[model samples]
Target: MEVHAHSHTERKKWTHYLWEFLMLFLAVFCGYLAEYQLEHKIERDREKQFIRSLLNDVSTDTVKLNNLINVRNQRENWLDSLTYVMNSQNPRSFPPADVYYYAIFIPRSIPLRFIPNDGTIQQLKSAGGLRLISIIGYDIGVRNLTRIGEVEETLINDYRGIAHYFFDGIVFDSMLDANNIPRRPKYAPQLYSFSDQNLHELNYKLFSIKAYNRASRRESKRLLQQAENLLTILKKEYHLK
Candidate 1:
């Protein structure tokens, strides 16, 4: 029988094993860091997209608010003139045509209303969440402005209800031209009743509508300011145009 000499291999030292373990640990740690960075970048990108969409919505709202403010100014002027004519010592003495002109605006006027542009905000609520745009505080402002707008509509309708006691629908209906603009009627305008009581109650209703209209306009201006402020901050923070 032939005896074979056993081939001996050098065993790895403890330090070598330790070095291998360190390299493996470092590989895993670096991979985890890379993954975390990627996720963070994705989140940041999503946030920026949301902000851009919100900016567009706010920009649109600002333009509408400005236009609405101007309309409200005109409406307020009409209300003032109407109130003056009604409160006169002798309301009946005033031109029926003038009274009819202003009374029609109090009822069935739709051009004076405003609703906030909240499409992006609604989308955010369904998507990630409002938390993404929490810094702007625009959502709360829009909601509040919407509530005010609804209330103004209700007030306007109520004013119309009270106005019928003093104004003649026939006269008001005749004053509107083909374009729905108040135009001088071919026939003389008239009122349903010019009694002191009707005039008094109608005046009160006008006052209510006027107050709410002013409030709504002021709220719109405030919301406009907030939108502008948020827009500035977002532009500066994101280096956006």
Candidate 2:
């Protein structure tokens, strides 16, 4: 048998191998850049969505604050009227009906309270998304609002305790109509007691409550301003309406 001849293959040059390695590296690097860009875009979109939701919440807060401010003003006036009538040397000189009406109104009236909408903020906190927002001032404003609300609640509780010493619940119940609305009595109503000590203590509680209400009103106004400021910032930062 005749022997077969082997064909020799040419070896690749070092430069050719280096060129192939460089092409692989370039492909990997380009793919990595593309992936990074896509992730960045997604995050940006999510941030904008969160900002829009926040704007809605803040807008609602503004409306509520406005209404609460008006209520507080009216309540303050009522408190002033009651205190003036009670401060007299002769409490009986004032109309019994008027005294009874204001006395019952104070403790029976519901507190003007506000609860913030924090759904988006809570979501962001849970999802580690607070980093998306650059402003810290908005958070501070919310905390201040919450603090004032707490103080107001505490003052209300104290006022209630003092009111129990001054007014009778039976009188309060009698003044309410079937729908729980206050109506003037056809006959003049009598106070539980016209004791000087009770009147003095009641006056103190009324003044304290008024002070707390004024503070709360001021805080609410500040918070409203802050919310508006935040809205402006969000709109400008995100180029939103």
Candidate 3:
């Protein structure tokens, strides 16, 4: 008789099950990490795009600011000459034509209406995450922009308001035909004739006007420097030109 050995298959050990469970947990964890990493990369890319746009906006602002400064400087010089002539004993030498030229043209470069290119900043604010540009950069940029806007509005607007009142009644007969440069406002108010112009009053008013203009000029300089500094930081940080 042949001895028959009952063959029984060995059951899977508990260690095997434990090892499988570990492997599944590890796979799930790794997949989650990969997904998280992908999301981070995407957000980072979006942030950089926004930064570049902001850089462009700032650059535009810088150009505009410089132009304004230059124009204002020339205006200041013209104002100085006009007031100097008025204060002189021989005010008749300069003639009303000269004064009218400076007054009409200088007022054209009204400082109160400076429009900063803030499209990117507005979008950033609306999008609800300024942290995209980094907390520090965002704060600095916003603060500077706000400061510049406020100063310009206050100082420049004040100057314009004063100019409007001061220039009242001092009319020019040939503003429209004088030069083909700027079109006269459709609702241009008529000016008083040279005979009706009062030199004493004009000279007195000029003192205050000059003060306001000088103050505005100072503030403009400060704004330009600050904006340039911020632009420098952005360029260096982002490796942008």
lDDT string for model 1 (1-241, tens) is 9999999999999999999999999999999999999999998898789889888888898998899888889889989989998887777787877778777776554676566678878887788567635443777777777787787777777777777677777777777788888786666666665677777777778888888888878888887888898889888888789
The lDDT leader among the candidates is 1
Taking all chains together, the TM-score of candidate 2 against the true structure is 0.83
* Better by lDDT, candidate 2 or 1: 1
Residue by residue across 1-241, what tens digits does model 2's lDDT show?
Answer: 9999999899999999999999999999999999999999998998889989988988898898898888888878878988987777766677877766766665543547777787887888888777634335666667776787777677667777766564666776787899887766666665555677887777778887788778878888887888788888889989999
Clash number by candidate, in order: 0, 0, 1
CA lDDT of 65 in candidate 1?
Answer: 85
By summed lDDT, the worst window of 10 consecutive residues in model 1 runs over: 128-137
Question: Which runs of model 1 end up more than 4 angstroms from their true locations?
Answer: 89-95, 126-136, 174-187
Question: Which lDDT tens digits does candidate 3 get at residues 77-101?
Answer: 8778877865566655555556556
Error of 3 at 71 (Å): 1.0
Q: Residue 240's C-alpha lDDT in candidate 1?
A: 84
* Residue 89 shift from truth in candidate 2, angstroms: 3.8
